[model samples]
Every structure is written in structure tokens, then in C-alpha cells.
Target: MDLELRHLKIIRAIAEAGSLTKAASVLGLAQPALSAQLKRVERMLGGRLFERGRHGVRPTPLGELVLHRTRVVLPAVTELQEEAVRFAHAFAGAPRFRLGGTHGPLLGGLVDRLATAHPGVPVTTYTSWSEREVAQGVGEGRLDFALIGTCGESPPPATDRLTWREVGTDPVFVMLAHDHPLAARRQISLADLAHASWTDVPGDGCFADCFAAACARAGFTPASVYETDTASCVHLVQVGRAVGLCRATFPPTPGLVTRPLAGAPLSWRHLIGWHPGAPSAGLATTVLGHAREAHAEAVARNTDYAAWLVGHPGFGPAHPAAV
Candidate 1:
């Protein structure tokens, strides 16, 4: 019989199991049948693939060569099947929009716009503190799109076989208690806050290091920095225990205020990503448009950020977009 994918699987199973009996058990075939099948494969290939040995079966030189090829072929075929499934889902009546995001306001805004634009399509979101995780979800077909950010011209997460687009950009802002002394200032100087402790949402990025470098440039080592969840970061800032680092579009909190840092010492760039081969890729442009619109709405609603943007020419999407 010609060596087909099934034949390759059988060879791999036997090699992995180390014996015909174990291989049969794993492959759900009777031992005798498996042995017979193996004989045919060996006969077709013109050599003994496995040698009968005291301990178990070992691959012959021929077996080793075939096994090497099997390893390469199996994964490629598996990937082909998986990509086909993703394509099918995209073309099927309606594929749910599976969005992966690092915690932020842009994700919610995009979801809202997508739901309104594609009325009947179901929408869901997966949140992670790591941009890599969000990007990975898209690359792995678990998510249709990824919403993530990079710090001030830093590259986006490293994910293979995916396209990343800049949704927008904003200067990172500082969050402080409403009554904090710096809260009254329109913009705070990084050097001036040398004595203050800080808090920020935890993430897998170089932002923490970048913040440190920014502080170093400002001529003082920063005080204690607490990495925590968003809620904890807010509470820390609320109680005046620490100041929080936030995106420019961070919504107003009753007891907290967000202000930009002078010189735009730290900044963030919003990014949207997706696997180009995914079935859902067809909607990427549309979704990107919505993301841009969401970002614009965010820009409009945050009056302080809007005023800040007026003077900071380079901190927004690379191009104009509307939805």
C-alpha cells in the first residue's frame, strides 16, 4: 500500500510505543492486525522498519529515516487542517467575534462598536495582562483579533504569522488621589514626583523598565513601585499610598485624577492584531475601522487628553479613520 498519512501515524505510534503490542493498544487495533499491517508497510518500503529485540522494537536505519519524515509531515498536515477549520468558521453563517485583549478601555469600545455594526454576530472577549498572550490567542486561532499596546515606539508583542496595525497612540498618564497636591496641576513633572511611591497594572512588557529609565533620566531613582491588578492600582492611588500609571483615555474615577507627565516621558501605542490566514480575516478591516472609531470617541470624551493631544502632534493613530 502507498504510504499515506494513516500509515505514517502507524509508524510513529509503533516507534513511540516501542513494541507492536503497545502500538496496537494505543492505536486501537489488535496486536496481530497491527503486526500484519506493519509487515505490509515494511514490505512496501523494501526494508524492515523495526527490528525485533529483547527489550522492545527499535527503529532500523530505514525506520529512522521514515520516522524523521513522518514528524515533519504530521505537523504540517495538522496545521493545514486547523487552518481549514478556521477558514470554514469564518465563512460559515456567522462566526462569533473572539477578541483577546490586554486590560484597557479600547477593547470595550471596539466590542461596543462591533456589536452595533454587525447586529446579530456574537461578540466575546478574553483579557490578559500580557500582550503576548492576546497576540498568541490570535495566532493560534482561539481569537479573531487582538487588542494590545506597546510602550512609546517599543515594538508590539512578538507573534508569528500575524498582522499588527496601530489603532492609536497616547501619552501614559499618572493617576493620583483627587486631593493629592499634584492632582491640581494640569501636567506633572517626573522629576518633581521623586518622593512619591507608584503603582501600576501588572503586564508582561518593558514598561516597568522604561519607567525606571525615564525616572533615571529625570535624575532620581523612583520610589517603591507596586505592581498589581487594575482595581488594586486604582485603590492604591485612591488612598494616596501610591500614584498609578494609566493610559491617556482612562475614565474619570470619583476620587482620582489622571494627568500627563511633562515631556511625554512615557507613552503608549494602541495596536490591533490578527492572523492573516484566519477565516475571520475578512472582517479585519471593518473591525480595525471600529477600533479606530472607538479610539476617536475615547479621545473626544477625555477632554483633558484631547487638550493634551492638541499640542502633542504625533500621539494618535497613524491615519484618519471613521466608522
Candidate 2:
């Protein structure tokens, strides 16, 4: 059988996954079909590429050689495909820029800025709760740029094909009913909410995990009630059914109140990521700047958070004077 780019992709997927079953799942192929294809590939190469074990598959010497070549070839092929698409869109006069990220209030402001700056270019935005997914989309050329949030001090994950810049860091806040006793406080300690039942937006595992870690550091385990939509979660918070975690820049909710977490054990870094070769890199930077402005605006609109920001100048927008 003749080898092709698809074969190389399959080889890479199997090598990375370390198991045909897992690779098949990633490739959207049945295990039996992937096994047959692997057999054919091995027959063409005239040797066994991987050693099959009960645990999983391990690359043999031959497999390692093939994977080394596949790694180089796959990236080149992807670059070629991306370049071709770019050229095709340009030629067709359908210049488009695709943006993706987890949902946040800043996204709207970024879009507005882009629209104002590049009125001639059509733009599209996609939202996913998973920042990793959005980052992957940018790396794979499926998106021109993405706005992702990373919690804690660790830098956001890096990709060879993408460039990432920190736009701003947003302090984490606790959301509770406006009438709740603790809501009157200027700031709330994680310890104060130790016994409070918490609800998180479903499918955002990173945020949920970060919240849990902060709770752990506060010397308690948070009682998780249920995962639900943001609107429902806000409703729950409004009625004192539960407390929720929110960013300082989150828009105000009528019946709910937000207070910064004392000491800021939990915070997130907002990052703007884009393909290194994308023509829209300059535009992406502009978007990042606008996002910072949007975040500052959010701070101004939320008096509680604005006051918190005043006390903790180290966090929030880099240039407060501009805001």
C-alpha cells in the first residue's frame, strides 16, 4: 500500500496515544479497522512497528524511526494546508478571521474592537468552556486566535505553532445572595465560605479544579451541590441556595453580590493566543489591548470589585490611569 499523509497522521496518533484503542478513539476509527490499517502499514514497511502488550502498545525500533519522520512530515503538511487555505480565502475575496475562547465579558469588547478596526474583514467567534480546546483550535489553524484563561502562577501551556501573550490577570470573587449576611462584607475569606454549598458551571473542569484547590488551601473541602448553567447558577446564588465562584470582572447580577476573595488565593491570567504565522497577529494584539480595556470597564461598573481593586493595586489592569 502506498503511504500518505493520512497514514503518517495515524502513525503519530498511535504513537502519542500509546494504544491502538485510544488512537482509534482519537481518530474516530473503530479499533478493528485501525488494527487492520496498522497491519497493512506494517506489511508495506516489512516489519513490526509496535510491540503489543496487555497494557498498551509500545513503539519498536522501527516504530520510533517512522514516528520521527512522521513528526516532521505532519507539521510540514499542516503548514502547507494552512497556507493554501489562506491563499484560497484571499483569492476568493472572502477574507475571514476566526476567533475562539471560553466565554467571558471581555470577549464582547474584543469583538467590537476588531469590528471597528477591520470593518472590511469578516470575523467569527466560537466559544468553548475548555481553554485547552480553544488553544488547540488556534494551533491547528482552525482559529486565527483565542482568548484563554489560566489559573495560578504557572504559565499557560505553550505550543510550537502558536504565540501567547498575557493580556491581564483577574482576581477571583465569591458570588452569593445580596441579602446574605456575608455579602455585606467588603471582602470574603475562603474560610468564611467553608460550609457554604457551591455550584459551578458545568463542563469547566479547570475552573472547578482551581476552586477546589483554593478551598483545600483554605482548610476545608467545598460542598459541591450540582453543576448547572450560568443563569441557573446565578439564580441559585440569588436565592441563597448556594454560593458560586466568579471573576472580579464578571458583570453584575441583580439579586446577587460578589466580593473579592481575601488574599486572592484564586485568580486567573487572561491570555491571547494566535498562530505564529497568522496574518491577523497584529489584529490579535489589538484585541488583547481592547480586552484589557474591557476588563477595566468591568471593574469600574462593579463598585464592589472596583473598591477591591483600589485596595489591591497589584491585580487588575496594568494601566489603571488609562481606564
Candidate 3:
């Protein structure tokens, strides 16, 4: 028979009891029946798992190795089952929204729409720079939904544990001080900023690597990239210390202008994810619809981005089928 968790438990039981007769008693099987099962298991494993001594039985070399691994695997399997149960059960509680997000504008809008969609149910949020952390929270049942993004066509984090639906796409843009030479231009070419210092909020995704690849394609190495928090990145750009790469829908700032990159060298895809087996699974479509609505609002609210999209037809919220 194919090895299974039950088989692992049986092996552990026999190893602990030291003999088939006693193990059979502990496992509620006749001694001969237990012996037969062990033979079959040993045949499948291609080695004897036990050796009879004068008083009892002892593990063979192969048995010792299998037991060592069984010790680690059984506990991990038990923990996984427990977590899966919790993940499914967490959605049954008081109607509430628990959202985790990376730094972005759509999260607040999603919070707004979800609050309105499920009124009286409390709404809570957890923010992390690590997209993996946010996705992990959703998988572990710590959050009901996750609002996260990936660079270009990259897959959303934790595809194995959560279901993801794309809400929108936006061309990555450059943020420059109002008086900076390139700020007045409608669009800035990546090559034009080749010599400029760059700054962006640190993140755990492939965004920085993607940016480096884009810069490589533009035929120049970036002067330097300052990895810091959002406020620091913005401040570096505000004082003309560096230019910040940001979303097209980045809010207008008094001292900065956000401009699209020429030819759309980099893009961000917004995604919403939930554990498919959780109680929140039933609301995935609703959450996705609301996420789209929030993205639309962001596009409308950013006048500079709105006008820029007028000429760039295919660069805004993604089509349903395209996701």
C-alpha cells in the first residue's frame, strides 16, 4: 500500500511498544494482524523495520532511520491539519473584515467599500511591507482578505494557499520635485533618468529586481538607489536628492510630480486574495468587485494619472478576462 499518515502513526506505535504483540494491543489489532501489516509495510519500504531479540524487539538500521524521519513528519502533518481547520473556522465568527495590505492607495478604498458592503461587521487592517506576510496572514486565517500587488505579470504571492483575482494594473511612474527639470514633461523616458539617483520604499517583492532589469534594458546602470521607508523616499525626491518610482495613481503632492515612464517599462498589478476554503470564500467575488470599484475611484481621483491615461489606452484597470 502507498505510505500514508496512518502508516507513520502505526510505525511510531510499534517502535514505542518494542514488539508486535504489545503494539497490537495498543492499536486494537490482533498480534498476527499487526505482524501481517508490518510485513507489508516493510516490503513496500524494501527493508525489515524490526528485529526480534531474546526479550522483545529492536529497530533495525532502516527502522531507526525511518523512525527519525517519522518523528519530524508526523508532528508537522498534525500542525498543518490544525492550521487548516483554523483557517476554515475563522470565517464563522462575528461578521467582520480583516484586510492586510502592502503600501498602496487601493487598500484604503477597499476598506471603505468593504465597510459599506458589510455594515456593522467590524473592519480591521494589518499593514506589512512584505507581500508574503500579508498573503501568509490570509492563508493562516489571521485576515479575511489581502490587498497586494506584484510587478508586471508576476504571480501573486502564496498561489498555493490562497485564491487571487486581479483588480487592476497601473504603469509605474516617476515622482520628481515640482521644479525638477523632468517634472514639467508629460512623460519621462527611463533613459532620461539614467544618471539620476533613485529612491523607493523597501519591499520584499521582485519590484527592485524588476527595476534593475528595466534599467539594464535602458542601457545604463542607475547611479544609486536609496532603500528606505515611504516618507524618506518621498523626502529624498522632494528635495531633489533622488527621484522616486511610484504607482501611476500616487496622490498629488505639493512639491512633487508623478510622471509615467516612457513606453511603460514597469507595471504593477493589483490583486485581492482569500483562502478558498474559508467562510470568506463565498464573498471572494464580492470582494473582487469592490476592489475593482476602489481601483476605479483611485484612477479618477488622480487627475494627473487620469489625463495621462487618455493617451495610453491600455494601461489602466485590467479587463476581467485578462486576469
TM-score of each model, in listed order: 0.75, 0.86, 0.75
TM-score of 2: 0.86
Candidate 2 regions exceeding 4 Å error are 25-30, 90-97, 116-123, 140-142, 202-205, 320-323
Q: What C-alpha lDDT do the candidate models reach, one value each?
A: 0.88, 0.79, 0.88
Model 2 whole-model lDDT (C-alpha atoms): 0.79
Model 3 Cα RMSD, Å? 11.1
Candidate 1 lDDT, tens digit per residue, 1-323?
Answer: 57789999999999999988899999999999999888999999999999999889999999999999999999899778668767666667856899999998889999999999889999999999999888877766778999998888888775457888889988999999999988899999998899999998888888999999999999999779998888999999899999989999998778999999999989898888888888888888988889999998988888899999889888865585421
Worst ten in a row by lDDT for model 1: 314-323
Best-to-worst TM-score order: 2, 3, 1
TM-score, candidate number 1: 0.75
Each model's backbone clash number: 0, 0, 0
**Candidate 1 ranges beyond 4 A from true positions:** 1-85, 91-93, 321-323
Deviation from native of the Cα of residue 251 in model 1, angstroms: 1.0
Between candidates 1 and 2, the one scoring higher on TM-score is 2
Give the alpha carbon lDDT tens digit for every residue of 154-259 in model 3.
8888887788988888999999999999888988999999899999877888999999999999999999999888889889999999999999888777899898
lDDT of 2 by residue, 206-259 (tens): 667777778899999987666777788898898889998777888887998888
